[model samples]
Target: MPENILVIGGGPAGLHAANELAELGVSVSLVERDAFIGGNPKKFKYKFLFPDLQPAENVIGELIKKAESNKNIRIYYSSEVTDFKENGKKFDVTIKSPKGTETKTFNSVIVATGFEHFDPATDSKYSYQLFDDVIDIKDLEKMMGEGNFNRPSNGKPPRNVAIILCVGSRDRHVGNQYCSRVCCTVSVKQAIELKEHFPEMEVYIFYMDIRTYGFYEDLYWKAMEEHDVQIVKGRVAEITSGPDNTVICKGEDTLLRGPFEIPFDMVVLASGMEGGPQSPEMSKKLGIELDEHGFLKPANITLSPFKSNKDGIFLAGACTGPKAIVDAIVEGGAAAMNAYIYAKKNAQ
Candidate 1:
């Protein structure tokens, strides 16, 4: 019998893992909670990826195509793992889909369930959803994907825009003390896009600290030096209604040590990432550990991030923590190799 491996996600990591395992001659079962397979990037309709700013379709679309064409792979759309149990070296898994629930035993399992975008409304300060012009990063991505650059409140171009960083992450008051790593780079990327789209529109990024890290700094530098995007050293504390259907960003300018309230045509909040409810659900079903930050804990974060604490189960992508798309893809391939080795050795 062939080594049957179960990959619980259809996102970048899971898709890449399934494709690799299929090429390795393993029977791959991919399960996704949503009807489609591309995960958040697909769900949010991301136009371009960060760092190099390549088209999202070029990366996510290729991964989906590769997995769908592979004969060794089977996909379960709009489905989830309802039950998981250990049966000696192999495991028995029950999948629930629209068609019906089916039980299958697999030699190894890989969990790549991704993260959720942090909702700015939960904080009550950013006034997300309360104002038509105030939106988050994901919302802007979707709008940009559809080639709609007009303000949500009115069908007119924004004169000046304020992009607020650190909406939900890195705030102890909001209960998440960790920084969502990609938000900084993503904000910078979107700022560049806005400048390119509307050169005359003033774009200001209100940030406590600009963290573009490593090679991503190139994009940040280009946003300012090349595009004339302004950087404000401050964090917006309150968002209130402004005159002429605009929104006011009220906060202290840390650099100048003075409080200022500025009105803008639109406000874009740089919301962070969260583990979502799936982390605890997967932990309970798979009997793995959850980290302090509410992500899936690996057997060894530094040595074997792809390996779970359980012998026959593995982990990949943002399920482990907040990660960039490229990092998630690499983790998916790594997890696939580890899972294949375990399945080959312990195959029944």
Candidate 2:
């Protein structure tokens, strides 16, 4: 029988790992909690300009189709790995599906479970729970899909919108010392989309720093020059609701070194991303080590990108760390290559 390789989470990392393993004649099984395979990338509707702006749906759709046709690969959608028993050389994995629970044995396991959105309620001063007009960036994206960008409290398009970035990310007080890697670019992209929708609407982005590394610098420039999105270097202190249903953002402009109050019809918290809430539980079950921020600890960055400290177990995608779509895909491919080599060397 071909060696069994189990890949958890049907995101880019898991799928890529499965694909590479199958190419080397290893039997691969992929499990995902969601019915779809794209993970967070599937949630996006717009195109990214840096690495060829293509609808996320199109890119993920093609990958899904390719995986489905692979003979040595099997996919279980809407399924999750509930338990794992490491037996020194192999793993006994118990998976739960909607129909029933099933257990299987595998020679190697790959944990590719992705990250989750940061909760805005972390900052009580933001008044996210108290105010109905305050929405997080992901919520705003979902609302955009509904064909309306109007404030929930009022049925009118926001004249002035304020977006706060680095919330729960890069904040030592929040205990999330690591940068989310994608929030800055995601916020800029969303800001551009909003400008496209409402050309004259005033949009302000409150950010500690604008990280537009690599080719993404072009997109950041486009957002500022073409879209006319106002970029403010400040850390937001609080958000409150006004009597007129407007949202008041209070923050000090770090560059100007002065306190400023900005009133907006709507407020968007460009919340950070972190490891999935269930990651701790999953790591404990699988005997994998988690980093300080609760993300899976990579074996090494310089030599190995997708390897974990435990032998025969690898990690990929946001589970290892926060990354954009392209970066995640590349990491997925790298994980696959590592898994393939491991299986080949240990072949019976």
Candidate 3:
């Protein structure tokens, strides 16, 4: 019999890993907790991706297609690994589905469970759920994807919008202290898209640090130079109700050392990323390690970033840490190669 592999995730990473191994003649059981194939990006309906503003469908949709068409890959949607145990060098995983529970043996397993978006409502400092006009970046992405980029209060085009960065990330008070890695670029990309759609509407990004690192710096520069999106050096301390149907952002301008209360038609929080409950859930179920940041801890973060603490189990994508879609896809391929190698070596 051909060696079998189990992949737990349907996001870009899981989907790509399944496809890569299937191409090498490995039987893959691709399981996803969600009913659909695409993970958060598709579930949330992200319209465009950063750096290039390409349609998110162009990437995730394509992965879904390749995975579904592969003969060696069997998809299990709306399912999860309910039980996992080691069987020598292989694994016995019990997948619970709508039909019934079926246990399968696999030579290797890949956990690509992705991340969760930080909910700004948790902090309460931004009045995220309190104000009608206050929405997070993911909410805005869904709005844009659905072709509705208007004020939530009245469904009117916003005359001026405030994009607050580092909302739920890098804040010790909220308990997450790591930079989400892509929020900065995603915020700038959205700013550019907003400017493109409404040239007259003003866009302002309030950030302690504009961290569009590496090649993503170009998107930041384009937002300022070409799109005229302004970047203010400050952090919004509190959000309160304002007159004339607006929200007031009260904060200090760190650069000028001046306190200011600015009113805007709408507010968008560039919320960070979180490991969510899935990371710990998987860690407990599969007997793996979790980093202090709450993401799945790899065997060796530098050399074996894809390998989990268990010998026959590997990890990829946001499961280990926050990553861009492109980075996740690359890691997916790398994890697939490693998983395949392990499966081939221990094949009966």
lDDT of every model, 2 decimals: 0.94, 0.79, 0.94
lDDT of 1 at 104: 98
Q: Tens digit of lDDT per residue, candidate 1, span 1-348?
A: 789999999999999999999999999999999999999999999999989999999999999999999999999999999999999999999999999999999999999998999989899999999999999999999999999888998879999999999889999878888988889899989999998999999999999888888899998999999999999999999999998999999999998999989999999999999988999999999999999888999999999999989998999999999889999999999999999999989985
| Best of the two (1, 2) by lDDT | 1
lDDT of 3 by residue, 1-348 (tens): 888999999999999999999999999999999989988999999999877889999999999999999999999989989999999999999999887899999999999999999988899799989998999999999999999889999999999999999998999999999999899999999999899989999999999898999999999999999999998999999999888999999899998999989999999999998998999999999999999999999999999999999998999899999899999999999999999999999997
Q: Which run of 10 residues does model 2 get worst, by summed lDDT? A: 43-52
Which of the two candidates, 2 or 3, achieves a greater lDDT against the reference? 3
Error of 2 at 316 (Å): 0.6
lDDT of 2: 0.79
Error of 2 at 13 (Å): 1.9
TM-scores, all candidates, are 0.99, 0.92, 0.99
lDDT by residue (37-65, candidate 2, tens digit) is 76765654434423445555576776677
